[model samples]
Target: MRIEKHPILTFERGKEIYFIFDGKRIKAFEGETIAAALHADGIIKYNTSPKLHRPRGLFCAVGHCSSCLMTVNGVPNTRICVTRAKEGMIVHSQNPRGDLND
Candidate 1:
């Protein structure tokens, strides 16, 4: 769910770009952030905590926090909140031990 009728910001998206999230195909915008795209697709849990395995989602919406960490194209610990979405980008949630979630 998003603010479709923002008084100041336009709701129109950029050029369409396809990507993989958890082995599923998802369409996002060219210049959108990974977290934004995931959020748009109703993916709120980006990672799980180490010991407790608690679900984590976008908190700061910036690169300053680890709440949005995930795996991008085989790389671990990627901050999706600040990383710009790209075409064919593979994104997956990162487990607490720094591995991609199955």
Candidate 2:
């Protein structure tokens, strides 16, 4: 979900990248945030709201809100929007209290 063409702006795509999402291999571009990469791969939902387990997604692309929090390599509360996606990294949706692996 990135602008393919812009009148005033341009994007120079980096090298092809790969990461692990929910135990599946997802292809993406280097230098893109985890959320952006995931969104490009059709992953919109990040985590469920605490307590209610209500689904949440990209409310704020910036890391100022809790909507995009997820587990990255076993660490909880990671703001994927600002976290660059690295090759071979493990990413999983976070639950109410912690990572799915926790």
Candidate 3:
């Protein structure tokens, strides 16, 4: 479910790779960012705010805002928008306290 036939960017589907999110199996392109792939899969809620715990998603789509932050492979405070998706990567939703290692 990609914009394969987009007008601007040439559609060059990359190699498929498997990754896990909250114990769920998900497939992503080799060179795409984790956020992009997740968004493509209809995953909008990335993390919650630290204090208010409000839901946050892709705001800037350029890593400017911390709204798209999530946990990746046990690393906390990872900016999914800028982070590229990799094979066998593990991504998880951040906790309400803004903690991922927990």
TM-score of each: 0.85, 0.88, 0.86
- Candidate 2 residue runs with Cα over 4 Å from true position: 99-102
* Most TM-score-accurate candidate: 2
Q: How accurate is candidate 3 locally (lDDT)?
A: 0.81
Which one is best on lDDT?
2
How many clashes show up in model 2? 0
TM-score leaderboard ranking: 2, 3, 1
Give one digit per residue, the lDDT tens place, for model 3 in 28-96: 888888888888888888777778878888889898988887788988778989898888888888776
Clashes of each: 0, 0, 0
| Candidate 1 local lDDT, 15-100, one digit each (tens) | 99989998988878888898888888898877788788998799998699878878898888888899988999998887665664
Please estimate how well model 1 matches the true structure, expressed as its whole-model Cα lDDT: 0.83
| Location of the lowest summed lDDT over 10 successive residues in candidate 1 | 93-102
Error of 2 at 3 (Å): 3.1
Q: In candidate 1, residue 75 scores what lDDT?
A: 82
